[model samples]
Target: MKPQHPSVRRISECFLKPDIECLPQESKQPYYLSHWDLNLLPIQYIQKGLLFRKPSEAFEDGHPFMATLLHRLKRSLSSALFHFYPLSGRLASIINEHQASILVYVDCVNTPGAKFTHAALDLTISHLLSPVDVPLVVHSLFDPDLHTAVNYDGHTLPLLSIQVTELLDGIFIGSSFNHSIGDGTSHWNFFKTWSEIFQSLPPDGDDIVSISRPPIRKRWFPDGHGPIINLPFTHSDQFKIRFKAPELRERIFHFTKESIAALKAKANAECGSEEISSFQAMSALVWRSITRARRQPQNQITICRMVANNRAKLEVPTSEDYFGNVITTLKVSAKAGEVVEGGLGWAAWKLHEAVVDNTKEKFREAVEQWFECPCTFRLDQIFVTNSLSMTSSPKFNIYGNEFGMGKAVAVRSGCANKFDGKVSSYPGYEGGGSVDLEIALFPHNMANLEADSEFMSAVSSPPHLFHQ
Candidate 1:
């Protein structure tokens, strides 16, 4: 694909103040992390799109619609931040004496405000809606450098950063956040709250409580665990292997309701069980297809790591509004030859079994074991060297967030630079039971997967391939 060059102008950048005048200040307020959070010790922020098509009314008059829209957006976001105070704060490190050395504790403290970067581009909404390469289009819509940074001493970057770009006939709202603060569920809740506040003004104005589920500041600690402040985790020496995904390209593949049903039927027939879900079927199909495309050695293992939402499954119930990460990875694997010989049904059953195996008791046991060690995560060691992993749940109501405008046309994950075999799934923009899979693979592998007739069969093409 030929490279695309577009002009993006940085209009203005500033820190928007929260609407609340006073915030409760505890000299040292610590936020506890679950075993799941510690495992993903250092994760790139969740960067995704909140795309809005051009409004119907033309702006031929002297009024500048872009400026007006931005002003309204800024105002509403300020109000939303008042409810999500943690996002407006920063993560601080507390050093205390442990055994022979020092221990570091990351506490949520200080308000530096979320960074807001506003820019405009010459590109049109059609360019984004059309069939364009992921890098060219997505890179321009978002600021790739906008992510939280952590130093060795544990001094961390801001919890949140947002970029609002104005494209001709569309608006792109991009957000990135520190994973230590929350997970996808928390991310979506903040956006949903912002949208509600934006859509409907508080009856008493911005002074009253508006969010449906304002986040709870209190952190949960399991039994036998007291105010655990120190994090002894460290990245493994095999860090290079964790990010070994080479020169890769990304493509968005769509699966319609019919295609999903066909996959489920075939998987169920193969397993001789009607209990396989659409997600399980789709996951199985993709895993098998990718393994085939990669054409790994027969003795090698092909693994699939599915990220599970542990909110409802946790032994202790966390408030729906509880802030912080509550997720874990469920892994299934087979020898490369085993996967090739077993077919889609075999792969799907493996995935289904893994999900069922993560019972509440198992989750509790895992947490209990984590306390015994409590070391920081070494990302590369978490999963098998060349395994495939998927994040971002399809259950998140990303499409429903409408900030006084219409629903977003699409959603995207910002971890574009991740290693190969990383995939994120979101509900398709089109309504029927469908899903959009964002896949990242080495260039040759991607080309091979695209050419595979069986894999390509379920993928729906874009409406207009306007590329010249």
Candidate 2:
């Protein structure tokens, strides 16, 4: 379902670079999908927010401020897309002669440019900053859905869709991409480059190199890799997932530098491990709190799973611009009773151990092993396995995305992701040791989690106030 906003209006729609001659169609390149990319289902969108300058700038020659700003953004974006052309391409699968298997690869030949839209809402920045949870208008800023192989109709949808919305105080820049292309790091890499173009187009004319570099096409294929396994996805299957307005609530909980330090101290003291990281401590606390709130049986086992990036962990040398998915999941399990009864350090140790176990060599070995027996790893399949899934990396420079105007005042996950037990994390908008946590859960479970004594004790007051 699409989000309806009374004041929202579309200004214009155009390809990133309308001039076809400027970007000649290059020879078709067949890029094979990695093991990580093939296993995960493509259902989610990677939405990012960028805050721009205020509307108070005096219009030179009395021209409208929004019109000038939109023109500038579109021009800069076109330049950026010229370098990142693969992003404008679509993903397609080549069927085998047996019709029993498919070869999934990104189709970069004869593809159209990315989709860019200019839009505005009749709202002020105050309306967005005042909400503890991100306002719904933010979700409506970009296209609501992500492109999937099942729904790909040759040339219907572009791989990327960028929307720039003008607000009373500042502008909202949002980009939605299919999750198959890249993970959070790759997504931020593109944003940072686009921002560089926005600030100043490179003098060399080829903005790709100086502007975060073009994506590396060298595929990562291991020995003994199995054939691609196809999953059954029907047209009606997309509609199977539905939710009502009252089903869940999305909220951002802020953990300040002081609070996180204190939590770290408590967890470290309890576990007696000096190597425990902030992510481990925080994730443990969240997992324990949610399990307690759910009031599950004491004997039940609660699992915590996080998508770990394998870029740096890989044995082979990957360029800084190596794009596409390079991530695998790390799972930690503990009895509900232990998580609820144990100190923060106990839970932190389990998580930290699980994370540390996946070293560079370990990741390569795992990928090679998965090739022996490839299977569809769907997100919904986690319920049967029983785990709390986490996406996005806290290390990502999400708030540091300065696009000439200024750094974003706040950042958030999309509201469409307000599903039970899903967690997304970003660096605090304030850019301190703090962390911003976006949690989506059922209304009653959210209420219980918020009311958890230990959890609230670590939550900062007023929830990290957003500032310009």
Candidate 3:
């Protein structure tokens, strides 16, 4: 078999804003952000995509095939923005010298609008997914300029960019969204709405699409601190950094339902308790395997900064569709030897306890502390640290997002916020509680993990799962 070199050529670029007539009066004003939203470095954007198999309709050429779909995509997305209006807004700063603080907000009045791009990939779906590892060419499917940066760029750059790349037998809808606006739930919710609208569009295209699960457009905040809160910094430039990441290799490993159950059973048997969940067991397995692969010093600390959604933990729980960032990173650390020798049960137990301890009270206390004195994130030291960050939960509905064409064939992410020791988990395409981990590591560490017998023992070869 020959290696594939995917050739991507741009067709068109445009900015799509929310329909002003459909926009509620409340959304027309400056939308303030929560501390949960502002806590992240403004430069980071969540870049991911969904691949849809080619439609059943026949066409003489690829250009006309795309030309037909583009009309429908634009209409549905514009309708999606009507509910997710804040995504089209720009990030603005308001400095108050007397208060000695700066306020960051979504400047709805001056929205640059979301960037929409159409492109052609001279390749087939099989050619795209033939590799054991995620192909590097997949990154080119997105707008490259919006990678890891402080969200402050929203002042000028489009806050969201959706690139539609048409392949021979499939189409990949890649989106670059600023992290300042929301988390994984918010990101997927936008896509879910867009797909639903696309499927529901009437032939005439005259009626406004009614939202079945309308987004909770209002942002979340603790009492008295917001609807509007000021950051400790006076200038946005203080958050900027020349973030240079090490060249890391990315590969995905698939865990079957049987394998996940086996891992959970093993961890529970070792702990003599059934409290260990499948997620914990699988995460622990990765942590231990990666620690061994890195060959960190026996006495050195190994931490898994597990990212958890804080939506349900809030004192006054908001709806699941809350349209903002509500998340926290909890750490579970142990000596490298302990993590390796303690067996999967011990590591999993630690993770389960940390998750249980992240109560709403704990989250609120952390927020209040941030209110006293704020600190921004610096991405330069991410790869240098001896810690690993687990992002994207398998619970997210990655496989269920269906446009008029069909449900996604495979989900892929871009090269943003990517560094050594970054493990992103997604539910397998086949469903039934299977898991797929998109893992990244330095070249040598990745090689060691690829060859690690214990890690490879539970991973299964994937099947051909894509369809129209």
Candidate 4:
């Protein structure tokens, strides 16, 4: 039976509004303006699901759930435009007039377990529905394609493919904006909101949510610290250098709280130092793993970049929800030989010192200095560890983010692929207190890192690791 709830015409009527006269004025922060520009393009990508069908049931009626989802999407888009200007920004460009196509791909000639299908969807639906605008939460067909599956040596290997179209599972959705309007967190928030609305839940009321406000005063003029790293216009001949195989990459890793605590204890004991947060300890382990995998001798400088959310640190308005990319990068450099010979505990202490010493004021100064400096110095990699202390866990039910489909299995940043260095984070995993640690790196580097015995042993052994 077809699910019927709201009329698309009524939803459209609710959303239509007069267009803004002009684009918002660009801020002095070049990074801010760059994000604005990126947000204008309709990005795309594919999301796969393993669909279970009963033997007595036939898929001839098509996916009613998906159909209902589309109907709700159209209505939500219209209502969103009527209620919020930012929502309108998502639909300014119409990529497809009708509902997006859904394609089914059969595996193993006529296997009975489950069927695989791809739905062409737009980021607009995901954006307006989520609770935050974190780039990772904005699922669409336009996001970059990372790789393709290939069979080799009795194992399926991923082939690097920068071609976005090939990455599509014959599904597409349209929306207007580039990568700049919001980050992964913002996108996730939007999806949660949309889901709530779709399920007839209370629309995001004006709750007293703590959002970072925009800067009240201009801090300094641009000092040309380095050239801006803009997205490349030319396509690389070999995708290997540009894209990493997504399958081989474990997007998320599970670790129990107890195990994490034990690792921290071990790290503190080895360093002969005071206690450090789990983030710092895990970062040390990752750094050791990466350096060891590369087999670089001691004394060679390896960089670890840490991402800091500047919502509270910026001189922005207290009321403003300092949205978009309010993130700053902090770098820690150490010799591979020092880490290898000294062990992870020593590395953890050094990392702790570097990160703690560069708190709020120091970060503010670093940003100012970067704007003033003329030299470009990009870190080789990044380590991010988000605790439940900041963002509410999906299990907490602090916000009704279930868009008829329940909360996401995982959430991450979309911008991870854009950097030369790897980006890793630990979001709360399912199964209660355990957490999922996500890591991204270049293919060759990731392959080497996975082969290390010490790192693998530690990751696979009793205390620290849990297979997700």
On TM-score, the candidate that comes out on top is 3
For model 3, what is the error of residue 47's alpha carbon versus the real structure, in angstroms, after optimal superposition? 0.6
Q: Rank the candidates by TM-score, best first.
A: 3, 1, 2, 4
lDDT tens digits by residue: candidate 1, 245-299: 3466788888888899999999999989998889899998788788888988888
Q: Candidates 1 and 2: which is better by TM-score?
A: 1
- Models 1 onward score TM values of 0.89, 0.87, 0.96, 0.55
What are the Cα lDDT values of the candidates? Answer: 0.69, 0.68, 0.84, 0.38
Better of 3 and 4 by TM-score: 3
Question: Per-residue CA lDDT of candidate 4, range 1-468, in tens?
Answer: 523222111111122321233213321112212222222222221122111111212233564654454455544433332222332332111122243311111111111211112233222332322322223322222223221210110011111111111011121222222223343333334444444455663345522122222222212222442223222222211111222324223334456666567668888998777667676776777777777766676666777666555556544423223334454445677677887778778878876886678667786676665434312211111212211111112222212344344433333433323322343444453434444454544456667776877656545322211222
Q: Enumerate residue pairs that collide in model 2.
A: none
Residue 328 of model 1 has an lDDT of 79
Q: Write the per-residue lDDT of candidate 3 for residues 1-468, one digit (tens) a residue.
A: 747586789889999887676778988788998887887654478888988887767345555666767888888888788888888888888999888788888987676689999998888877767777777789889887776555777788887899999888789999998888988889998888888888888867454689788988778777767888787777776766656556888888899999999999999999999999999999999999999999999999988988888888776788769988888788888999999999999999999999889977888899888878776666664444677888998888888777767777788999888888988989998898988899989889999999999899999877576632
Clashes of each: 2, 0, 5, 67
Q: Decide which is better by lDDT, 1 or 2.
A: 1
- Give the range where candidate 1 is weakest over 10 consecutive residues by summed lDDT: 233-242
lDDT of 1 at 340: 75
Higher-scoring candidate on TM-score, 1 or 3: 3
